[model samples]
Target: MEAEKKVIIVRFSGELSIKPDAEKYQAIERLCKQISLRLSEKNVFIDITHFHDRFQIKVSEQEVQSVCAVLDRSFGVGNYSLVDFQCSSKEEQILRLVPNYQDQFSGAEFRVRVKRSGQHSYSSMDLEKKAGAILGKTAKVNLSFPQKVLHIEVINEEAFLYSEKRKGPGGLPPHKRERALVLMSGGFDSAVAAWMLMKRGVCVDYLFCNMGGKSTERQTLQIAKVLSDLWNPDPIAKFISLDFTDSIEDIKKHSSLTYRQILLKCKMYEAASNVSKILGCYAIVTGEALGQVSSQSLQNLRAIDLSTRVSVLRPCIGMDKQEIIKKAYEIGTGVLSAKVLELCGITQGKAVRKANPSKTDEYLQSLDQSLIEKAIQERTEILLKDVDGKMLQSEYLFVDEISEGYEVIDCRTQKEFSQWHYAGARNLSLRELLANLKSLNKKKKYVLYCSFGTQTPVAAEIMQQSGFQAYAFKGGIGKLRSLQK
Candidate 1:
């Protein structure tokens, strides 16, 4: 006998349902397109039915759960159910299907809920009472607060049955909203901010200020690629990268340390505004949480943003750090954010908590405006999908290939280096490399390694970009040890 086919019932958020008829229709259409594209990528063929209240997706039982997981993470999905069995809508057939689910309500309180669509000889209440009659004997029926609830949907000639539903990320689909540029930092907060906007139906473009070095650019590009692939997946999304090293250097020379951070932020806004105007973005979004850092205070934000006419949106402003992190992990960017090489060298020492607008203005005026304009003019635009594949593959060298005058720096934590590292390798934790990048001798050749070699590319790229010859040790310390054995 052939196995029973399964289907997923997906429901849009209450917000989408309450929109005007035209708006609701458009939202549903966009959501359906996204769902179809995502499902097609998984090689899953499904029949989608858009009912008045929900979307019914029919697929094989084996792929039903996988399909549901994809829909669960997508925007505009309020909740979803997995329907495994379908039968004739007639009262006799539904009654027979009820007993098969009796094991689920075993020794637990259960409830029967029914919804009807097409003309049926029996009302929903009639079908419910019949299913309840057989269920009451095996399990206690608590209509108010049941541990398990069996849902039945009678649509035209068929009735669908399901017991559980999963919660979905409830928001309007992306591409329905206006386009905006996100000041992506590839960190925990910024990526989450971009996600929040995407979840709320905003089509986002990324604007990255490459202040840290090539490593920062590479890491930011990867994070942006992940965001583009998962949430939006639209090929038209642009990843705008600006080399802001000259801008940062100019700030260091002309601006005071107390207001340097705020001044640098202003320059970013100025550049973002220029870029946004060129790209036709409606606004600029950031991951800045209010008062999370010295530079994010309301005063500092106000002072830095004093010059831009482009609207700046901070979605994570009111949210706490832990809340933002929790969302990042939920959306699958937490691991990348955690592993990203952080550049703590931006600040000189204690930064101004609340920057005075007058002083900030003075500092901004002191710097050559041409610096920011030049960076924006030289901005490179690439499709988000192509950024990752375009990274210059780092060369890898084996232990035997280590020649004279080559410096081997272990890109691991200090504790890991202390535990056991290769002979003559200096500990330069990924965090420390960014902090003291300028001090490294640019003329010298360097060999970078990490546990299993996953992190060497980041350090090697940073070194290579800083005008030094760098190679990642193939297989890291693990490969070297194995070679010795």
Candidate 2:
């Protein structure tokens, strides 16, 4: 029998802080479960050394390894090394490891970069020479770009040696105890806000409300599902969810294209406050950038604030679109988020308008208060998915379109489907998928998903070959779960 290979997963390149710790630690747990469901391998290991500044939970040895191994394959890790690790002091890190790196690549053309977490004994020039001396004079490598590169980390207490550049969910790590409700629009801004907060360790729950319009209705909720799927692939994400759709829609029923944006937002905050009260969340989060849109104006923002009692957090408020995209890239959610098709993208007015607080208030008052309450009572719901197609636990504002025509299917386990599933996708497991397959309507649209994207493909492929039109959720249950606010 082949020996089980042991691989190490390391996290690097993120600024750590104490913001989303609760949500972050929960994410770690969720990630572990997602990994376990993926592969049968038993020798994976993960070291969250880069989370030095954050308060991460200490998982068991087996659990850590399991999470590490799964993420390596699913999320595209930089280096999954099969080697022994020696954690020693700083001086030892330099003297012992430097020579070892040289011996490994005797003639390979390469460059060495030394990064210090604190002051070190060797000068910058001295370290390069040391690396060069260790390698020998025969090696010809460009410092700017080399075939092989060595990364040396000199920390305050110790050092680490790795042959690869690892990537991390960069941003401030999630801090425990801090809570924020995200204003999740199915657009770039809100999605980026949630990402920023997740990086800093803030446990962010979502409050996505869509105003009633002639455009594709449930499409916004579907978009939220995509983002939720990408972020919380772990089937355990109760971290995010939907409020009510009807409540917000009611506001729009009594309003129009004029100040509808302002009034609708105010009502959303009100319903969000109710959601906050129920979920024990503290503040609200949004994807607000300075001067980005009419509703984002400082005056209009203040008017919207009048609807809620909690503090509001705008993670993207100070960031530009480019900056937000860069962060998204670092977190690996860029490609998935990029694929989303939001209905609201084309509706914005070209002329920039600063909000008038007084006018915004007037707009809010113009809507029927009775209609607002009714909209709150009739909330819509949805599920989010991740890059790998795991559905995040989510709740979204209800749109009438869900029950209208489309056929939704839950490809999760029987128990999972029983516990909860999308509104239309009756409970069905992959094992029993084909048996019940004949019942599906061939003419209608369909969706398939597993807990994360594991089993959906099997069902999707079967349906497609069987002459039924089908779509496999890129991310599965974890994404869907994030939609339940």
Candidate 3:
């Protein structure tokens, strides 16, 4: 005999259900399109039928697990279940199906749950009591807590029997809200912030300011791609990258020592605002939490806001650092984000805790605006869903672990290396490495690491252009220690 066919039942989120009828319809349609696209990408295909409160998808038993995984990552899906059997809503039909489940429920505590939507001779309570008694013959019935739950849903003239319900991300569908641009840093904070906005129905595109050259850009893209392919429901999300080396240099030369960090932040805000206009984004999203860092203090944030005409949205403003990291891991960006090193080399001395708005604006006005405009004009835009691991790996600029037989170079000061260094690592300052590049063996692979993972990439790129195999260790010293442990 052929195996019984299975179907997936998807319940819409409560937020989506409360929208106007037209909006609710559009949201459901968008959700269905998202599901179809995601499954098609995975080579799974199915037909979806929409009901008043749920969607039913017919799939073979083999497709059920994969389909459920897609639903779990999909927004606007409240919960889903795999239907084991279906029959007429009559009490007798349901009772007959109940016997089929006894073998699995035997020796375990089980409970019967019934949800009815249409007029019937029997109410949900009546059906639950009857189903529970039948299953109790083989298993113990625990109303409070059961190891197994037998679910029965009666809609009109049909009944669906399922074992357990799996949860989804549970929010409104993507593109249901206005589009916004996110300042992505490929760290736990920005990634989780972008996810929060995506969960709330906002369509998000990323704007990455290149501070650490190709390594940073590649790592950031990898992180953004995860968010795009896994969390985002819309495929139109773009990753916009712009080189900011010259801009940072300009700020360093002209800005006050204490104000450079704040000035650099303002410059980013200005760039994001300019790009947001061209992209038609109503607001700019940031991962900044209040007082998380000196530049993120309420006063400093207020000063940063002064540089942008576009509205700035801080979804993570009230969240603690631990909370943000937890959410990042939950959304699948934690591992990738952890690989990103913080680029704070531009700031010298103590950064201003409460930057004066006038001073920030004055310093920002002194920098060359032409360079910012030029970077914007020459920026690279990528449709994120089209990106894959092979494409990202083509850069060959970063490594998570140092393989045996590879020469490890510690690109920190002699004093710092003496304090602590990776085992079997040679202490070579960046200048010394570049100076001795010609004498180094081209036949062997070299891994370079610095305190912050900033200079190693630049050095690695130079070595690569000179015909040497080189890579910067990802996440700098902090991540290196974790790997060792």
TM-score of each: 0.79, 0.56, 0.79
lDDT of 1 by residue, 232-288 (tens): 777678888898889888989997777777887888899899998888799999899
Q: Which ten residues in a row have the lowest lDDT in candidate 2?
A: 392-401
Error of 1 at 68 (Å): 2.4
Task: Report residue 43 deviation for candidate 2 (angstroms).
Answer: 9.5
Winning candidate number (lDDT): 3
Error of 3 at 127 (Å): 1.2
Candidate 1 regions with alpha-carbon error over 4 angstroms: 1-5, 387-485
TM-score of 2: 0.56
Local distance difference test scores for all models:
0.79, 0.54, 0.84
Winning model by TM-score: 1
| Candidate 1 clash pair list | none
Clash count, candidate 3: 0
Query: Candidate 2: misplaced stretches above 4 Å?
Result: 1-134, 140-161, 172-176, 211-257, 322-352, 380-451, 454-485
Candidate 1 has its poorest 10 consecutive residues by lDDT at: 389-398
Q: What is the lDDT of residue 55 in candidate 1?
A: 91
Ordered by TM-score, highest first, the candidates read: 1, 3, 2
* Candidates sorted by lDDT, best first: 3, 1, 2
